[model samples]
Target: MDWSKSKSIFIIVFLILDIFLYSLYLNRHTEAQKVEVLGEKTIEARLKDDNITYTTLPNIELAPYISGSVKHFTNEEMQAFNNHEVLIENETKIIVTLDQPVPITDVEDPASYVDFLQTYIIDGTSYGLWEIDKTNQSATFFQRINNRTIYYNNHGMVKVYWNANNEIYQYEQTLLLDLVEFEEKEELWSPIQVIQVLYSRGLLKPDSQITLVKLGYSTLVQFTQTQVFVPTWEIRVINSSGQQEEYFVNAVEGKVIDVQFDQSKVEEDEE
Candidate 1:
């Protein structure tokens, strides 16, 4: 009966609905912007607020993904080693117990042990000393690719145990073979960005001291005998109570990495 009036009413109703929907969208968008801005706080400011202290961050800019298979010992290679009981596990690992424990003049110095490693380990120079656990009387060396460490990859590591006399008695070694770097290098996240990730995730506690920050590679994908590694940042922090912790961040993906190793498996392997 009143077609023109009814059409106008319908238009007004639709117009009001459109405005209401647009308002909602605008509010959500604004809120998101605010969240992002707040989240992107300056690294220094955030650290200062938490009483977390750090020295200069490393200036690593880019890195490439790398892949390699575990080194399989050949009969010739096995024979080349001297003066110890050697066990080859599936041709992928070398376990050596010294014929007589070799005394390290100064366990704290690399020079005291570097010669022993060179004389016994395959490609010993490729490994860098990672840690010396005095409580356990052990030293760990991790393999390096392109002068950067392959952080704690079982496929490429050396662990030596010392006897009560501070002499190295036995060692377990595994190496990666034919490591190939991808030609496509990716720009890595800034060190601060990675640290920020840890802070936001509550991994970095207040009143902690950031003692060390370094670039390395952690396992991104592991196969039966091979692994793919991505650039990662390993940060060491000392809490107020004097306890130390290590955390990792994926430099390429800008996310935290779980640094916990399968301790049970390691113990089982040692047995």
Candidate 2:
């Protein structure tokens, strides 16, 4: 009923609202500034203090998560290849034995090995050479999507077994089907962030040398008919004792993945 009294009350209410909004803005600004500064320096300081050394981090900025199902090989599809005895297991894998062993003319040249695979193997172009186990006279290849390796997916890989003659006698293959990327891409965590994650979790020992750093995808979830993949960083480190280990970090989520543990769990679930 009193006009002046009502005006004064409204002014007081607006003043309180302004103060509340400004406080929220200040809090958010401070947090962001801290992140910007800490993200650049804190990780480096921690890594140095822990006596960890790494190769240069990549300049990569953005990446996307992807998902796909494992291919189910039908007889019709499996019958396409020649000169090899192809066997389909559970309609999901191709196990092949060459009627006669193919000589790998150059054991030292990795490109030569890839050539052999592309010539005699199905979906060879879809795989990237992973490792050559000289002790076992074998080589392993991992399936690739978007030109990036899918690290150690059981359902999507090739294992080539060679005789002492350095000839490929047999190889098994699997593939991912209907690969699709998510519409929304993510800003990946830089290599520094990934390393810091491992160090903070006590995964990286002091005086460790990171010998290899690569960008790839690892299994995110395994469903009965499909599997989801996410961008990950594969770091190979050698400790002070000269022992080597590999670690995977989820690029988007910044979580370290115990690859061996996850692989074992997957196998157990399948069984």
Candidate 3:
């Protein structure tokens, strides 16, 4: 009766459905291509272009934490090598490599990374969380004292490194096992105030741009068995030449730590 009419109608409906599906596939493909091309990018930053006056800050001294009480341990006792491929050379040093023969994802959260470190990389010692720099997939831990975080980049801290393959390839740990709290709370200076001090001292150029204003502990006192650490604000400024320079201000004492101080400390660390 109407068989020919029915066949034509069916073919037309299927054609419309196929076109709709093709449109959806194309949209998804375009989005995927965009993400692939853009990749992961960092946020650009610049320094403030404003007039400022720097005033000297009164210095406040801090007593050393756990002065003269250095705990000694063999390399074997220090590194937590529980079925993990690792190398330990001293009490305050550890290096571990990825044991699994598979891809590992870059760890974003600092808390979770610390836990992994504690279980697989560290042994018999606990640490305080400071910050995680995701660009390099590196995690830096500090010594928590009296509610203030002290970041001794080389002398008394643990830094973990992840490779491009997202594998936990290497990590360096040097922590103060015995940290005593200060009697009084520390008075920290704001980043803006520190920036002004740097500008007035001719340390920061007027045309220089600041990339980051971070607060952490400066490198530890070198060669002192009983080393002390101070709270510091780090100003990362990019010059007009596109060179990045890091300026450290003693948060409590109001002075610059300088790059030489850090370089010397890092050179001294065996790990």
Candidate 4:
């Protein structure tokens, strides 16, 4: 054997192997550190962008079924769930804050004075004041009540008056100066008013007919028509007695339109 040739070959092979191992180690270390840095940056960016100000932790508890399903969920589904959770938490916080005590101010004759408040104040709730505007010769009320800062004409009905806020500890008469004259009562039936009248008169019963005698006719029919914008139907009801009667009633408004008796039918039934 040639000792010099063998020794040279062994040295060359060992050097080659050492270089390969060193390269592998360096590559592995670089990859591991790169992943760690990327992960940390991603977390920091998320926290900054979230913009959550509350210090309290969310009270959401994962249901067993949902947790199990999430284990196999896709990336999109997971992202969507996280977004929903964030939205829900934000909404809850907003609702809680809304329930806190908010200062409310009633401006006299809000329709006229709202402009003044909007021009001067930056924040707070301003309500319309109901007052007789002598200049306009009509009952005017202000409308902008919920933190309105802009001034505009014909924004809402005249706030002529408001009852006391029952919830508040102190009671105050919310009044505004009357710059305009009060107009004569105009006959207009709002939806709520119409419903209230029907309910109060016991005319809104379903699947039944109410017969208004002459008394019912005068009280229910024309008055309801003039008040509400709907027509009334006149229905004639015959009792078990041998007497026929006719009645006029408003079907929709639940008011008695007219009532008359079928005298012939009543006689026949009696026979």
Candidate 5:
């Protein structure tokens, strides 16, 4: 073998292999750094950069010493007592009358005459019982009712009643039985709930604060709205890296709505 020729070939092969291994190491290092940065920055920060907004509603305050019962009635009975109204007799008597008969179909569940009374009659009457004058076609209370009022309208199938002591009373007459059905009302999502969602999804850091804002992005520019419906501090961020990435963050509740590459930013990076 020619020693000089063999040595030259070996040197060339070693150089090529060294270059390939170095390239692989550099790529792996870059990928690991990207993952670490992503884990640290959070989705909330990314959303803030994008200018999305979040909002929250004020809490409701309950009244003290406010209590009442519920009533239900059949359509036939309500119809029978339509012209004649029920009256409550106590220290004061209040008259309750129906311009038209209440239909059984209008009443919700837990059916009973008392349910109808609770629903239609306001509270604070001395006499608990009173009779409707069917012949007279009017409801008369023997005495004035105390701390109570009655309201009724013929437009809806069910009538709502409200009573006030310290608290305000509210009621609504059902316009159409079919249109309105009773369901358990649910409370709105709170800010804490939002945060939990984001954190659980690995979109947010538990220690980081999130700001909600309206974001508008276009081909020419991207900007955030000044007003935030939810209480939050504005945070400004710049992505110094050439790669374009997206983050998902919610204001009212910390939920990750989306995450993706920003096409415009990518184009800018290329340019």
Candidate 6:
């Protein structure tokens, strides 16, 4: 009788239901993708084709150490202690007295003092005890990445000075903060790859041999909001006349960056 008509109606209703369900599924999927995109860490990278694309992935966040013990100096205290600040581009200079005078004997043991500094004073996780030179009455800690130590006078450094009275009179630190590193450090270009890039860029001389390659952090660019340091490949090369030259390479982007050395510090140290 009307069996054929009922069957045709049933088929159309099922098709409508299928289309509605499919639309709902697509909407949910699109929403999920948006959430994922928001949570991801994205970096712009130039491809071989000379086009930039966002490489989104998880990354390691390395921030400067500011402990609860580090208190901001008040105006009266600054005046009393003779505080001075010299601001230069991305670098900030702060010379203020501590809440309590730190003793030299407390930090004379290099390793233990270094640990204390990390917990209370210095920022960044890329440092290890390098040397304790009593002649200068100071301890020198070098910035490091794994087993590879960064070249001298670059990256985060802590130079703490103590007096004959065993009182830690002063401490100096140059810190690069808020660095983003590739979670999969394996993704960084190898030392050989960086060397090739350097040679291609006419930075490395044919007669020069690379002396050391260290992984560290270098300020890529500075923003008003924050300072961003890139995971850097610091390579030192020695030439015919025994001149040692250092070059910096961005680990993630594989590009060479012009690094400015603190030559004044070198000269001062020589004095």
What TM-score fits each model? 0.78, 0.77, 0.54, 0.14, 0.19, 0.43
Cα lDDT tens digits for candidate 6, 1-73: 2578645654554455456336545554343232212123221111222221111222333322110011222
By TM-score, the candidates rank as: 1, 2, 3, 6, 5, 4
lDDT of 4 by residue, 1-271 (tens): 3578645654554455356336545554442232223244443243344331112222212110000000111334324322222111211111011112223353333344454334322221333443443443333333232222111122122222222431111111111111121122212222222222332343333333224321111111111001111122223333334243443332222333322211101011111
RMSD to truth, every model: 17.2, 15.0, 26.1, 37.8, 28.5, 20.1
Q: Enumerate residue pairs that collide in model 3.
A: 47-210, 151-217
TM-score between model 3 and native: 0.54
Alpha carbon RMSD to native, model 3: 26.1
Residue 238 shift from truth in candidate 3, angstroms: 4.7
lDDT of each: 0.76, 0.74, 0.52, 0.26, 0.29, 0.48
> TM-score of model 2 relative to the true fold?
0.77
**Tens-digit lDDT track of model 2 for 1-271:** 3578645654554455356336545554342232323354577786787788888778788887677776778888766776669999988888999889988887656787877877876667888888888888888888888789888788888889889898889988888877778666767778876776567557789999998888899876676556667788899999999999998876765556656412512111111
Candidate maximizing lDDT: 1
Residue pairs of candidate 2 with colliding backbone atoms: none
For all candidates, what are the clash counts? 0, 0, 2, 37, 24, 2
Residue-by-residue lDDT tens digits, candidate 1, 17-124: 456336545554342232223355686888898899997899989888777767778767777667678998878888988888989997878777799889778888
Q: What is the lDDT of residue 33 in candidate 5?
A: 33
lDDT of 5: 0.29
- Poorly placed runs, candidate 3 (over 4 Å): 1-71, 75-80, 101-103, 107-115, 123-149, 161-164, 185-193, 207-214, 219-224, 238-244, 259-271
After the best TM-score superposition of candidate 5, give how far the Cα of residue 91 lies from its true spot, in angstroms.
32
Better of 1 and 2 by TM-score: 1
| Over 4 Å off, model 2 | 1-41, 260-271
